[model samples]
Target: MDDRLRERFAGLWSRTIGPTGAEAAWRALDAGYGAAGRHYHGWGHVADLLAGHDAVRALPDFAGLDHDALALAIVFHDAVYDTGRADNEARSADLLAAHAGDAAAEAVRAAMAMIRATAAHEPGADPATRLMLDLDLAVLGAQPPVYAAYAAAIRREYGAVPEAAWRLGRAGVLGRFLARPRLYGTAHFRDRLETAARANLAAEAATLRGGPEP
Candidate 1:
């Protein structure tokens, strides 16, 4: 899977910034996602996002989506992740913008916006943006065991946080998503994963609060 992702991303990067830059960009991406202390926001998470992106490319709604820009967004969205930092998304976007070089100005801007929007998981007017956000959040709708593993990985990422604080913070984040009218912005994701995502969030929230096993 890692090798496949490398080939896919290398191809996209070559198209975006030329072959000369693809090697360095791939090295940076691999190092960033493979960095120490990353339990959840790692290469595996990026791979999942890319898989979700590929899964929906055939949908009519995504026909107009900027495939290259969306791919860039997925690859760089969490490239600067840090549990102790609040500006990872901003930094990640900046990192992409720096490496974008002479890539199409519009595509670079669009990718940066999509990367930043992941901070709040909010969709903008663009269909690509909506799809990007949805793909980044696809894990929310994973099967119960998958979702449980994701939750555990996140907890491990924040291992420095006190248990009480981590539980409260994690539950609060889940509650905010649950409070939204819809967790998924794309109709495709909503139709397929909304119910499952909601159940997963609620279950995780309950467990966080020490209410019951789910």
Candidate 2:
């Protein structure tokens, strides 16, 4: 809860979706998905991604884009996340439309498209989308303790699933993450964190497979 982040969120709230509506929407989302619920992809996760995106922006050669739109997208990326639901994106889009009006609604839809596109690791996706997706998955490259906590949070979010099913599903996700050429395709992230990210993913994958630490 940095002051700058709070200010930024307030600005984003006032700009796209009027202050009152944004406040209400955020409160609803916060109450439903905040830390108390142990939601892995909640406000804290969005805040982390926003911070990563800002860090990326400071790198040389980073072209400026629609910061507000991207910020809004990040906030709502997991707005409708449900471990048992297959239509999270659609549901998120609907919620954004209802709460934020038409323009913000469209932005949410685009964000949803970007999110779904990342699942396939599409080669032709836009650079902004790539960066956003990478930031979303950046937890995988965090320090072991941080990553372990993230893993536990995710497990809690998906607690409805049986342990065996959760393990297999999680392993499949890590495998897909490993298949990517670079976790973050942006030049800055590739230069600074790619090796460490790969090592982290590899270690996690090994642990998932019940192998000794690397």
Candidate 3:
């Protein structure tokens, strides 16, 4: 999975990070994505985001955004995922910063910002940031079975926690998404995914609370 992703990144950023530097960064990121307990936040997630990005990258509104930064951010966003840590985003940002030394200054900065924003999936005013968030959370709006599989994969990742505790923690996270004025940040995603995402989140939250799902 990462081999192809690595190749794509190498091809895309060869000018900025150079071929050798790109190879090194890919090696580091490949290992990070292969980290233990990364059931959902692993290569599959990166692949999904990359595939989604391809669909939108050519869109006129997105064509001007920093493709290199967005691509790098997608790779590093969950690079530091650990079941025990709360600072995964910060750590991931640090990892990207450390490994992306040869990338352009602005590109690296953009990558770090997008990576850090994943901590809360906060909405941002800018189209670039909005697209990043939308791509990251696109799975929330996936078809029912796909979304269910994603939910289960996430539960497996947190298997260390007792069921009751995990339920409470996960429910709180879902509730916050529910409380958001909007789940999707970009107009493209908002139009295509918002309703499904809200329904999926709300239904899962209800199930966690032992109530009927909507």
Candidate 4:
């Protein structure tokens, strides 16, 4: 990891888990991102989410948010990612509960809740949840070349799956995103990300469906 990201985690860990535990957590998260077969969910993904969070944080609605807690959540949201498992968020949340300070319980709780909501991403009433989910989904709005690379990286992570099954499953996911009335949860994101996301998803879904991407 770069020094800035390393130092960001360093500050978070030192404040929440102290120097020793912070060191350990830092090593674990850094190593986790660098682990084998994590093309899509690694450091690049975290960096994107961090950038999205920064963009959203500037918005009037989220200006008063507890950024520290959300930052913790963003870094660790996919900390235990396993493409085949449904428990990654829960496991990641468990890791946070074990390491974070008692003073952070409320934020941790909110973060964990937001992380879990990524599973279905159904409509939500909580403002924090909306922003968190939207930030994570911002990758959908990336320019075509970037989105294509993102798709390829994900396919790499699921390399074990047979091509036919991967096609069906991946198509289902893209179809669902297309089905959503609005891919973004926040108005800010809807304004900024929705159009590109729609184009990307439609193009991907076409490719997955045996048609040429638009």
Q: Which of the numbered candidates is closest to the native, going by highest lDDT?
A: 1
Candidate 2's C-alpha runs over 4 A off are 1-7, 18-20, 103-112, 115-124, 211-214
- Model 4, 52-81: lDDT tens digits are 787668769887777776778888888888
**Which predicted model would earn the best TM-score?**
1
lDDT (0 to 1) per candidate? 0.86, 0.69, 0.84, 0.81
Measured with C-alpha atoms, the lDDT of residue 190 in candidate 4 is: 90
Model 3 Cα lDDT, one tens digit per residue, 73-116:
88788888887989999999998778767557777788889988
- Models 1 onward score TM values of 0.94, 0.82, 0.93, 0.92
lDDT, residue 2, candidate 1: 60
Candidate 3 lDDT score relative to the true structure: 0.84
Task: Pull out the clashing pairs in model 1.
Answer: none
lDDT of 2 by residue, 78-146 (tens): 777767778776676566667766555555566666655544545354766777766776777778788
| C-alpha lDDT (0 to 100) for residue 30 of candidate 2 | 64
In every candidate, how many clashes are there? 0, 0, 0, 0
Task: Count backbone overlaps in model 2.
Answer: 0
The lDDT of model 2 is 0.69
Ranked candidates, highest TM-score first: 1, 3, 4, 2
Least accurate stretch of 10 residues (summed lDDT) in model 3?
12-21
